[model samples]
Target: MSGYPDNPSGHMSGSARTRRADAQRNRERILQAARELVHEPGELKLHTVAKACGIGQGTLYRHFPTREDLLAEVYRREVEDLVAAAPRLLETHPPLDALAAWFDRVAAYARVKRDIFAAVEAATWQDLAAHSLGPIGAAVELLLAAGRSAGGVRADAEARDVIILISWLSRLDDTELDARGPRLLSILVNGLRAHHRD
Candidate 1:
């Protein structure tokens, strides 16, 4: 017997699933276009992104009300991707190494997620809640806790501080990051240095 008043597909048509699949495909395509634009610095155009996505201008407009909206979606999904990686990294690497590896991933995002992130930082809570953003703070707490408990990270550090670093990092151009990242990251690692007991 079925658990509901109707079978699983009773209320829905084949068209519904097809539509959902189409929507997902479009979202993926949009994200890919966004990635390309982010990597290319200031050369992005609406038509270029749409051409890369293989979607029409009308379709892109139907999905994203404005460039800001598209940018926001990219950042939201980027955070979702980051949040989802923690468990898999934990399984494959020691806590400290996992944290370090994740930092590398973040550096990549810092490079690519730049255009989208500025829009996100400007977002108010009400503006953001429309999109059902996930809880990044919890994800941060979990990862940082792992690093701290592994006896390889600073006990005094918190994820909030890391959040600030990442937020600022994405705003830099490659020239700036190439000039500054090594020294700043070295300082960061040194700050994470744990105290040795006698």
Candidate 2:
């Protein structure tokens, strides 16, 4: 046999890897709990999250030093999920349809932002806002380019314009928004559509 440790399970096998995997699982559980709790005013208490996660305070703190840190990570992960949806939307629908679907997703994201805005205020919301739009802008540009190429959207459209239109949806009161947001967004999408050619 070789001089290396006689392990039948490959070159590495031990509790260290198990501990790391457990840590990762705990981290995800903590974030999920945070996401749910952030929607409730003053409910983002870390102890609550730890209790929900069934982990010690030390484990939660190991993943996030402060409530603000946890909030920022949660928001960042939410934005990442939004960005990741673009390709999946495109795969399932035509360009314009995909863009429309993505607009709906954006509306949902904006609602979440409004819900969590109070908690996020204590964190680096400005810095997060500054950088978060880049991924969204790029995703919008991709969708718009595809729409124009497919002759489904106006050639003159820019991602900034759509972003501006969508931003308005986030500002409305939740009730009014719930009542009219879809109609307003439909109009916006309809306006963006390319005129039918002969």
Candidate 3:
């Protein structure tokens, strides 16, 4: 018998496994570096990202293929993280608390989106719209429904309103946002709360 066992699927080889692990690590490093740098001044440069990740331009290009691809992937990951947090938050907190906490996360997501739009000015409305608000809308709907059922929120509150309110954060400066975000968010949460039962 040969030193290596018969592996038809090809991934069972030790060298293949090592390469896969290395690729995953490199991919993570590239993404982390991009996240750190994309928010800074000026446009994003692939070389800078590669240098920060300690990887060659060839490797970065191999993984992302294009700058738009990289930006889209990053944006998708951000939305996915936000959408995934909804269920976890609901499980851990009461309905109203969960809704309030989700708004905080939405603010953070808006910040990330602002940086992304700044860095990739040509990322097109269609490119953005392709991400589809379905997941986030569903998350907000779940929270709103829970809040209403628990008698914590107004019966007329809509999920789209929460999204629109949180989106306003994208228009504020970092300094002003830091100063006013809490109060503004408090107003928003209070507005959503039930003042009188119908």
How close is each model in CA RMSD to the real structure? 5.0, 4.2, 3.4
Error of 2 at 27 (Å): 1.4
lDDT of 3 by residue, 1-198 (tens): 566644866446787678889999999898888877887788888899999999999999999987767877777888888898888999999999998898788777777788887666464535675554778888999999999999999999998998788878878877877888878988999999988737
Clashing residue pairs in candidate 3 (N, C-alpha, C atoms within 3 angstroms) = none
lDDT tens readout by residue for model 2, 1-198 = 466543765654576568779889998999999888876656579999999889999989999999889988887888898888888999999999998898888877887666555566644787877788899889889899999999999999999998888877767777888899888889989989999868
Candidate 1: Cα lDDT at 51? 91
132-185: candidate 1 lDDT, tens digit per residue = 233555566676788788877779878778777765666688889778765666
The lDDT per prediction is: 0.70, 0.85, 0.83
- TM-scores of all candidate predictions against the true structure: 0.76, 0.87, 0.89
**Where does candidate 3 have its weakest 10-residue lDDT segment?**
123-132
What's the C-alpha lDDT at position 3 in model 2? Answer: 60
Evaluation by TM-score, superior candidate among 2 and 3: 3
- Which pairs of residues have clashing backbones in candidate 2? none
User: What residue runs in model 2 are displaced by over 4 Å at the alpha carbon?
Assistant: 1-14
lDDT of 3: 0.83
C-alpha lDDT of residue 96 in model 3: 91
